[model samples]
Target: MSTPQPQTHQQAAPAPNWQSAPGTSYTSPIPITRTHLGHALTSEWTKIKSVRSTMWTLGVFLLLVVGIGLLVAANTDSNDYADVPYTIPAFFGLILGQICLITLGVLVVSSEYGTGMIRTTFTASPQRHRVLTAKLLIFFVVAFVVSAFAIGFVGLITSGMHGGASDNKWGGTVLMGALYVSLLGVLALAVGSMLRHSAGAITAMLGLVLVPAILPAFLMMSESLRTLGEKMTEYNAPNALAKIFELDSENGGGGSQLVLLVGVTAAAIAGAYALLERRDV
Candidate 1:
């Protein structure tokens, strides 16, 4: 009897339902949410803040702007403020300081390309324009805020040192100067996006900054090109910043400079967007 019972092998019980119906969707235990521009912006902000280059570049910018401004102020008499706004000294520092900002702006995009991380970024976001927009917005805000703070600090200290010399609407000029530098940084960012090479993009930006200032002199020597050179000299980054800081009254006011920069930046940004969509990362 024991041999007969052993011959009847028991069949295993069927497993529980482990698969969903063909037409039904499974709800994941983890929360699933759609991504938006804010998420991309947050991601970009995190990336920008986490990198060492951001700190190094911005720190140098601050050092150049604040240090040189203070040094110039310390050496000059209060009477020097009679002809120009107290903020004039900051202009000298910003000329060099803007190079730091331009480098940072190029790094913002070109660095990702250099490391081949841009592919990962695109894979995660899948929306190229959104990513570019996030980069532009985050970079602009950061550049603007830091620039404004540095310029304002220098302006206040200089004014105090000069016994609040005639105001000359110094507060407004501080904001304008910050905006100008920030836009330049944005333009640099757009250029980086287009070039996708750090050194090349940076070199191009430097040309944009320094060429106009220097080339105009040689062009003016050639009488045929005098008007063209004049326009370039009038609208170059340094001249624009100088006008904004009230250091160059011979040139037109900062408003026209801002307008020219705005137009050029807009065109560059548009071109960047076009290239980003058509080209493979």
Candidate 2:
């Protein structure tokens, strides 16, 4: 009677759990993989170029960079090189180029907060640290390109102004100048993250980039302070970054890594990363 009642369906059994080796560290969640990092970088780059502000900032930077070089070229008389060390004044663009870099840099992260898109960003990509790394990567890439463009145009325009053959020295300056300008964005982005406010980050950036630039000019007024500050601006500090591209001075007191440069860059980035990942959006 039981055999004739009906055949019952049998279900598959659940899989067994495997245990890990004892005393080994266990991280339930792994970091984002390289593939994810690449995807995030691509996404970030797309986001950067799609914005109108990016275009506007880029346009303005190019204009200022090119404009300053031409102005310096036009103003250069024999007197320009009479007392100063370098023959070409094109490197002068470094000063003006920084403004554009700072503005764009702030917008990079602050813009996200402004539009309330940060939540959307994080929601889509929960691996928050990877997002930051992507932003950093994209910023550097953009900076490198913008720099090449600015330097290339300046060189072409000032070709006849400087008699010194466009040798490796000039090449080095151009490259370094571009890097310093671009890295400013990284610093700005960090501050933007930490303060989570554009105004605060921008103000801090001004304090860092602007103060160091003008300090050298003021130091000239007082011999003792000038000597000490000159040591700071010209070489003994983070201003040495400029030297990598040959922006250092003839007297060896011209430009070293401006102390603020390294400190600002490091502090801003770390603080930003911590605040960004640890806190709620």
Best lDDT among the predictions, by candidate number: 1
Candidate 1 structure quality by residue, lDDT tens digits, 13-113: 99999888899998889998999999999999999999999999999999999999999999998888886777777888899999998999999999999
Candidate 1 lowest-lDDT run of ten:
1-10
Residues 1-281, candidate 2: write the lDDT tens digits. Answer: 45676769999998886776788766858685545788888889999999998888888888877877778778665444443334234456656667677878888888898889999998888998888888888987897789767876676566556664344335555665666677777788777877778888789888876576667877878877877676556642235544543444554432335344556688778877888877989
The C-alpha RMSD in Å for every predicted model, in order, reads 3.2, 8.3
Candidate 2 TM-score, true structure as reference: 0.72
The candidate maximizing TM-score is 1
Which residue pairs come into collision in candidate 1?
none
TM values, all candidates:
0.91, 0.72
**CA lDDT of every candidate:** 0.92, 0.70
